[model samples]
Target: MSEGSVRFDSDALQQRILALRGERVMVDSDLAELYGVEARVLNQAVKRNAERFPVDFSFVLTKEEKQEVITKCDHLQRLKFSPHLPRVFTEHGAIMVASVLNSPRAVEMSVFVVRAFVRLRQVLVEHPDLAERLDELEARVARHDNTLSTLVATIRQMATAPTAPSRQIGFVVDPLEKKE
Candidate 1:
């Protein structure tokens, strides 16, 4: 293939990287597409060289996670009915896949993939304030959540609690009373 055909946009690659299980990962299908191979082919290669990919490097999504990805990612809607769960590769795992594939396209695209991950990390480092602000916002939300939960619990208790009997408002006469 010509160099022009192998061109990749870092932004496009970064978009494919997702946060799953507290780590940045690219779906196997996305990597396969980038590397010019079928998803199953890539997975088969990974399986053949399983030692190269540790748990931290790659993992298959659970049923609930697969459903969640399908629900959230419009592109992954195709995977909704797929019998096999999709595998996700971390930054290191992507490099490992490139080595395993040993294809010119895979090697070329792996550089772009690494850059995309680095660019994402740079973004966070460049704007520490954004992360700090997010943390503050999360703390505020947590406090509000606690307050709301307490309020709801109090309301529920009040609703379920027994109430005391009320005294009669009008004057009462004793039974069998003699008139003066």
Candidate 2:
């Protein structure tokens, strides 16, 4: 994943991230990896330009939040090895940060991340009606509160009538389970 340079649009990335959650708060190390710089360097830049980053713009993770994030994101477990807690930055903070760092790569990559956030936000917004409807249906199902035959029939109707897509999502026990 770190062989050569690839072209990326920071604007698009920012947009995608915004769509995801109006914020592009990624761990410092992940940003460093994307920008092809050391995480220490990014921190240094932020420290040097402290005025540009406010509480909303950027801040170090709280100890409790850091632990929670680490647990949720398996890929970040290695962060435990570091002495310092990770930092998170909102979109505005990230954009300001790229300038402070003043590296072409950082600037370009920041735009890509920004666009990505925006795209995510857009997807969620676009589905508001569908999301609301699904929530209502779920609430109704919960109110019924029983795995009745009528409920099963309704669920089955929602499921494939056997002619729809054969493949469906489901959970399975460990495939290698030993037979009792």
Off by over 4 Å in 2: 1-4, 7-24, 129-180
Clashes of 1: 0
TM-score of each: 0.72, 0.60
User: Which residue pairs of candidate 1 clash?
Assistant: none
Q: Backbone clashes per model, in order?
A: 0, 34
Error of 2 at 82 (Å): 2.5
Give the poorly placed runs of model 1, Cα more than 4 Å off: 1-3, 132-180
Residues 1-180 of candidate 2 have per-residue lDDT tens digits of: 122454445443342231112344877777777678888998998899899999878878777777767776776788777778888887777788788888888777767666666776686698878767967997988778765767898988979566656665697678799979
Q: What is every candidate's alpha-carbon RMSD to the true fold?
A: 4.4, 16.9
Against the reference, the lDDT scores of all candidates come to 0.90, 0.71
> Ten-residue segment with the worst summed lDDT in candidate 2?
13-22
